[model samples]
Target: MNIYLVYWNSLNKFCFRGILDESIGEGTHFLIPWVQKPYIFDIKTRPHTFSSISGTKDLQMVNLTLRVLSRPDTAKLPVIVQNLGLEYDEKVLPSIGNEVLKSVVAQFNADQLLTERPQVSALVKETLVRRARDFNILLDDVAITHLSLCWKFVTGGNCQRCLEDAVTRIGSSCRKKEDGRALNSGCYLRHSPHKFYNNSSSNDVAAGNRGHRKMAIILAASSAVLALLLVTATMGFFIRKNVMRKRRERKQFGTLLDTVNKSKLNVPYEILEKATNYFNDDNKLGQGGSGSVYKGVMPDGNTVAVKRLSFNSTQWVDHFFNEVNLISGVHHKNDERRKNTYTSESLRQRFNRDSGMHS
Candidate 1:
């Protein structure tokens, strides 16, 4: 089952009798179980951050964070495994990166380091790229994400650089590994009357901080205003929709009342409820496909026929309103009973014919 394992986007190291042989490309390559073994290497490009503390030429300690985009060089996979094994980048990048950074940074002064950042980055990347070729690791990109002065930096008088150099020399005496490179007094400023650090630099940094704070505040205010506008628009949309729906309902009620006024058939629901005993089945005289007809006693003790429409059909609403409109202008030939059990079919037919509809 392991022999038929599927793999993609990976490099496989094919070995015979547990000996490092050759690297293979992506695909299923079955092994001979005990005789053959394959080591898989994920050849995906990923970023590695390298942190190193190195002094600038002006003797101010600068901390550097190097972001290196790397992947295993496919052609050199066997050599990579033999040399540094699976954790090749971890073994090689930090050593080379620190060496390259310290060597490159020692050539530039602290003032030039801040002012000429692009040239500094290019030089570091070029040096790292050249050094990485021998390690079988391909560098896609190299960048200095952070370049900052140490927080422990202090400034005093005209002899500040010299004092700083002597103090660093004293501090490096306790460390054995970095003892050789620690006292890097590649000092740019010598016995000069100028201060190594000044008040104006602090003011500039404070101004930059203020500008960033203002930008963040403006961004937050803009986001809040935009959110408020969005909520207002949403609320206005729903409110206007509700108002329009209510207006439409009012218009429909007004129109129904105007049409019923023409036929003089504006009987209130309570009066009809009382007259028909709340639509009791006993009061129902006849039933048809459209509705039921009920006999009712009016307020003047006169007999009346009330038709109740069947609301089960979706077309009932349209049919009910249309019938009222038809009856509104209709004139019967008989001119007889005002309240009858049946509608005037002949008059209704004439109204439908005049109105250009059969029923």
Candidate 2:
């Protein structure tokens, strides 16, 4: 029991232990064996978040998650114990929070709450802090953790801008890569084998309303005609420019391929399946909860351990690659050191005429 030292009388052999008289922050406190009675009160920060349904100024019913951080006032401990007691959170705080949230939300429209979250949160915190002091509680902060509107409105202008930026920027920058994705605040661009497209159907609908596809085709056709005329007018200059551009592109491709080859640690699934004879039971090396390991022989007579990871083992994929990268770095460093040592030893042997004569 958490008992503060209140009044102790040795002559009468009576002790009073209560939260009202003295302040005890936290920890175990031993009381007089029989005469003392103990009363405990928790003095820790309390956090609570609950969903509240409130009507906005625009008559829209919105659900918001109201979060409150508070603690009992150390100076007003006696008042807190005498009046509110332990059931304050259940009986008092929730109702006060609900009322304050409704009053604050009724002042703003749903759009204001959505667009100006910081201002709304600050107002709630200020109002709640003042009110909590009356109940002998110190309010730390208040926040609208989440706000959900009854309906969502998609802006056509934002989606159009996102699509234009992605198409013009990602297409030109990531043209050579087979697959990639670009993300923005409002929309995302996804690339597959076919082409880049908006991940959100809403964005596609919005952009389509502007006739972007038709405009693109029209521009392409017009550009092709213009290019044909220009080439006819300056054939030699255009040809020379195209040749130089092709040469530069070839050099870039070679550099990229070389870099990729250095870190090529992936094996095709189909090849692994074929090498293990379609994961025959006879070729299985071990089996466990996370799936089986198999022994496979490559065409070059090199044996490899192929793991058939379970579908549920997806969480380990990142860890597997991390360990692989670390091991690769260590091996690469060791290879470089060995190469340098061999080169140094060979040069020393070649230059040492005394050692050669002794040999």
Q: What are the lDDT scores of the predictions, listed in order? A: 0.70, 0.64
Model 2: weakest 10-residue lDDT segment is: 336-345
Off by over 4 Å in 2: 1-19, 25-30, 152-359
Q: For model 1, how does the per-residue alpha-carbon lDDT over 90-187 read when each residue is reduced to its tens digit?
A: 88999999999999999998878889999999999999998999787889999999988753444555347755776576555544432332333333
For each candidate, C-alpha RMSD in Å? 20.9, 34.9
Model 1 TM-score, 2 decimals:
0.41
Relative to the unseen true structure, what is the Cα RMSD of model 2?
34.9
For 1-359, candidate 2 gives per-residue lDDT tens digits of 33444341111123553443555445445555667655545556789887789999888888989888887777666666568865666666787888788999999998899898999899888887888888988877787888887753347986798788888767887888888677655467877788455578888798797798789899999999999988887988888898997676446435533533454433444556677898888999997554577887766676666655443222333333443354346654323321100122332342232211000
The local distance difference test score of model 1 is 0.70
Model 2, residue 210: distance off in Å is 43
